[model samples]
Target chain A: MYVAAKGGEKAIRNAHALLAKRRRGNKNLPSISLAQIAQQLTLAVDRVMAEGSLYDVELAALAVKQARGDLIEAIFLIRAFRTTLPRFGYAQALDTSEMLVRRRVSATYKDLPGGQLLGPTFDYTHRLLDTSLGVADEAGEVDDEARQADPADAAPVAMPRVTDLLGQEGLIEAAPADEGAEPFDITRAPVSFPVDRSTRLQTLARGDEGYLLALGYSTQRGYARSHPFVGEIRFGDVEVIFEAPELGFELSLGTVQVTECQSVNQFKGSATTPPQFTRGYGLVFGQCERKALSMALVERALRWKELGEEPGAPAQDEEFVLSHCDNVQATGFVEHLKLPHYVDFQAELDLVRRMRAEQAAERPADGIKEAAE
Target chain B: MALMARAEAGELEAVLAGFAPLPAASDLKPPEVGLVMLRGRTGGDGAPFNLGEATVSRAAVRLEGGASGFAYRLGRDVKAARAAAILDALWQDEARRAEVDAALAPVRARLAAEAAQVRAETAATKVDFFTLVRGED
Candidate 1:
């Protein structure tokens, strides 16, 4: 029922050539630089970096440019490139308590510590597109007063987390002990059903933002809902420390920008426990507040069993959520349909044709005679 | 080392040029680009988890005088890593340590200025809350 056929080697090469030309839309227009994409299209770079699970800004920018601004394609490129490199070390767990605070806000409390600094967020901005941005000359204009420049002393030198405040009062659940046990590495090992919190968190950290967003949104719509509140959302840079084999002691490996979200969810006390606030954690590379927030929501939803809540929703199903969360794998399987499945399709076609012919033969002159009688 | 890693694209090379006839560094470990898994604690302060991986380039080099040094940074800059490794080797010599510091002074200044700017910008957004009084007040 199946036969092998191969042809289209030259066609594939020519198709790639056409694609390269199409990527550069106009012949006379100036080509975009990697620096420009890294600087100007920063959020795009951040998204690709987050989803790609690779923290190199320059490479993400290059991938974006080469993919012609297709983020998933860019992510695929980064994922492919990541496999070629050897993993040298594991960094000491990031201590975000010492983050050089850029944007810090808490929805649970209004006048909390660090006093809610809004650093370059588009939260309050009207969604309308400014026509000026379309014009090259007008786009360069800067309004000084719009920035609301103030003295340096206004922001406190020591910014603390809102969760720490609630944590102090024993309102929120405490952090688990630092048991020197090694967390399961999602990349190194194949993920199986019913993973630990560490694996689930890692999977969600690099999971497709759009997929997580939808799943998170579903939780809010009462599918295993956990009344969630933004305990704190902060975007800033933290120094990475690594103790490489060559260097025995811990050494600073520069800083990486990250967005961290901690969600406080309402929990009903179980028979053995007292009612208290629970937490959902999310941390991702670069300043990806939206993705971080969505990750937090879904993270809380996924903890249904551990928290003693009934788990029937799709978000609550660890195997279902984790298995389909990775966009690269999802896209690959979905897009593979485009590839030549001639043998597979031909088998189905032949089966259908033979079945129809057999039915016609079986239907015989007796059927016509019976109908006439 | 932080200053060297944080320097601009060509700043390390520019600073290295100052010491024209520098001691050659032999590669103990040639510059290699690789990934370093960046781990994070749950709830921002809990049990550790693998958040993601960052691109890290590392190199180890030994000076002619037997001083070995290493460099690691969170990007794909092999040249920078090698230059930093060489600087590390040079700085191990107490006599040349001051020289390395003096060369990297500009980078220190630049980093300080950038931090101050971020501080000022972030400070501007800090909410200055005022309490609202009742009608009797």
Candidate 2:
């Protein structure tokens, strides 16, 4: 005899308990602290903050630990939490030229003003596993000279950028500024056709990392190849400002670490406009430079509208890329088809039955004609 | 703090009290109502195709509070119109703001409690594991 299933709520509760027990693994062991993860797994924290669109490093670390290192799940958690937070105010537009330089480099020039500072990068390191690091513990020992260094010695010094040099020589086109222009907010409002540059960059910043990476790689493989050279990549902290209603002028709110990228691309002028060099801009929260640089190159490719260039490739088509870029919406729609749809199935069945009966009646007449022949 | 404005309770009551004598939907002469056919496109820039007709109702009213309210309801509802007019008066009257906030207290509390519950349940599942090595000679 068949029995209908019941106790769904109870079953879910029991399953949750089992999952909690499994995650706890050996209760006798010491518990990991949020501080340790924030310090040791800094790169993972950076990725979480970048995708989550949250500036708080500590909160990102907590989400990572809670999600058990599933970056996407952590991002979902952060987004959900962020939605509940009320809109307090808007921050003042940051000036990238005034950024306190930590790590700055340029590919267009071999050497420039305020010489290259390759601070704490793994670019030149060999990809080899070190066996000694597994059991090494040098926690308490500290060098006296390094510890006694003056606090002023560690302060960031302002460095001149390479792109400014090009701007001075008139080699690169002057940066355009529309101070009175309104910027669209992608989070609060739905995306419409012919989006502005700010909204496009916002979408790309929160876009799926893997999807953007593949799209970027396709360009390199000659899909919509635009010759791009890294003008400059800088990482450091910049002050955020917000204007108070009572106060006429803007005031400093706080500071946030950011990575900014500028890419120079070759553009032959159109019939009406003179030929000049163009540029692409990318800015992301936290210490993520490579992704930011890739984003800048892709952004330039998408700027076919303002640049008056022909839309000949995937990168040039704005609607096609932005519409299909979001992972959350894609995952939901794809997965939701698995839910029950008995009524829809019944309607399809009725249509099929009526069509088959008509076909069956015509089959005998066709057979009789063939026999007569 | 500068943006905050004070709203009192008695002023809200007066606004709500004035709305009780408005003409009912059935009593007022029925205005012209019709259905407009909406066209749907196959794709974003594809050819246009006929979808279906949607019923829309619109009404204009002058309140005793010296403010006119214009409403467009998706479906035909006489009671909804009367209620909407009352709401429009309360919205236009700055003095009724405090009373409106007081009326919404219960709903806001419920939503906040529900959000807190969800946060607590999610936080409870978070677990961290670590390994410690003991030194012995």
Candidate whose TM-score is highest: 1
Give the per-residue lDDT digits (tens) of candidate 1, residues B30-99.
7999999999998878889998899998888997865887888879898899888888888888988999
Instruction: Please identify model 2 stretches exceeding 4 Å from their true place.
Output: A1-7, A137-156, A246-249, A337-373, B1-137
Tens-digit lDDT string for candidate 2 (B1-137): 00001112233244445545543323122332322222211111112222212222333455553454433332234234434444444455577657645654544565445434433332232223334687874
Clashing pairs in 1: none
Model 2 clash number: 0
TM-scores across all candidates? 0.94, 0.64
- In model 2, the Cα lDDT at residue A197 comes to 66
Task: Tell me the spans in candidate 1 whose CA falls farther than 4 Å from its real position.
Answer: A1-5, A137-140, A143-151, A154-156, A361-373, B128-137
Question: How far off is residue A220 in model 1, in Å?
Answer: 0.6
- In CAPRI terms, model 2 is classed as incorrect
How well is each residue in A1-373 modelled by candidate 1, as lDDT tens digits? 3355688889999999999999998989999999999988999999999999999999999999999999999999999999999998789999899988888988888888667888879998898888877776475555644654555474437777778899898888887767999998989999888898889999999999999999989999999899899999999989999898866788888899999999999968688768889989889988889889999999999988889998899889888999999999999999977777798998899999999789779988876788899
